[model samples]
Target: MTHPLTSLSGKKGLIVGIANRHSIAYGCARVLKAQGAELAVTYLNAKAEPFVRPLADELDASLVLPLDVEKPGELETVFDAIREQWGRLDFVVHSIAYCPLEDLHGRVVDCSLEGFQQAMRVSCYSLIEMARLAEPLMKDGGTLVAMSYYGAEKVVENYNIMGPVKAALESTVRYLAHELGSQGIRVHAVSPGPLKTRAASGIAHFDALIDAAIERAPQNRLVDIDEVGATCAFLVSDAARALTGDTLYVDAGFHIMG
Candidate 1:
């Protein structure tokens, strides 16, 4: 069976925040490459090299650079590296997010100011940072996608500061889409149901949370990382040209439940 994504034979992509094969970003990278999109990836530090190196080699990525969201100059360095290697980019996937573990396992109202600031900075502000740097490289226009979750729209216990971070991310998508539309660039969010990523495991009771999601969602199962990846590939592809400034839920219909 043929995949429903647009042909990406000559396009290039930059995907940030891939830590391992189980990561949603890695899923996106895999599908995008399978569909003919040339890829570039980013790791948070040298420690991640052992994990990301094989995947980068597997995809025949144009480049793989270090990019810690909190690290000064990392984003600029990666963008410069991409520019040097590819000159132009056709798509970028912002798969990065963070929050203090203490804040995530407790009440939202109890979250510390520092925790909130850090969460927003890493999860929400990073997209803006990427957009500013990538816009120039997308001379012919391109797609920008950010990862989101159901917690941003509904109350999910143990999701705390990260929920608001996703809310800000979703809102930023609209603002960016509006600003970048004239240049023919698209911006959107892909919200997936709960899944156990290395980051997700940090949240207290994450296993029970996944069980609850599988029980309540229409599919009666947690969404696979690859499913999220495939959706991302479609969103960034040409077939999804009519879509922008929207949050497309790939959450097994969990977001729609009461």
Candidate 2:
């Protein structure tokens, strides 16, 4: 047996937003699965299945699901499947975020109404939706985590509308923590330094961001998904019972720089 502070053996968790091998969600899923947690993992759509299924099979995930949170009835279907299979949820890792290409490239002020609304709904509101749906399933109390970026706090060029969107997501984490605390539920925002993930490809000049993170971070290096996953594993473990509504930076001290 492993250390209880980090052992998730026999626990159950849902992992969303794994687009491919390089995804941060994939990293989190890998670590959780390694710790013996049974996982319920999602792919964005049919085109994504080939990539995700292999990983799920590798992890021995209990359920490999199609979870387009934007699609009608889709989110409910996933939760329904989870209820039918495990009947309880011990943790969740939410790493999905979306923004239209134009809005992502444009100034925040120029973001279209539709794009802004869609971004908020998918990136921020989805976390709230998951927390509400998981509350009852977490009868013994559990942990909920979502991915965030430094963009949520400070101005990061080319981050554009996502800056505000992530800000909203971080704030939602706090409110959910407060509302769910009595039940022993914990909520957190894990902000990682920029990496070369498929999702990061959406941002213009992301290479620059990656380079900047390394150059400025005290460690003089970038963080990998495994590093981020290690922290996620800890946060969901019983050892982190006293922590809630906080943002955990797995950014290699990048946030400490000017």
Report the CA-based lDDT of candidate 2 relative to the real structure.
0.94
Residue-wise lDDT of candidate 2 within 1-258, one digit each (tens)?
779788898899999999888999999999888888899999999999999999999888889999998998999999999999999999999999999999999999899999999999999999999999999999999999999999999999999999999999999999999999999999999999998998889999999998999899999999999999999999999889999999999999999888
lDDT of 1 by residue, 68-159 (tens): 98989988998998899889989999998888878877788899999889999999999999999999999999999999988888878878
lDDT score, residue 75, model 1?
Answer: 87
List runs of model 1 lying over 4 Å from the truth.
1-5
Per-model lDDT: 0.89, 0.94
* Backbone Cα, N, C clashes tallied per candidate: 0, 0
> For model 2, what is the error of residue 59's alpha carbon versus the real structure, in angstroms, after optimal superposition?
0.6
Measured against the true structure, the TM-scores of the candidates, in listed sequence, are 0.96, 0.99
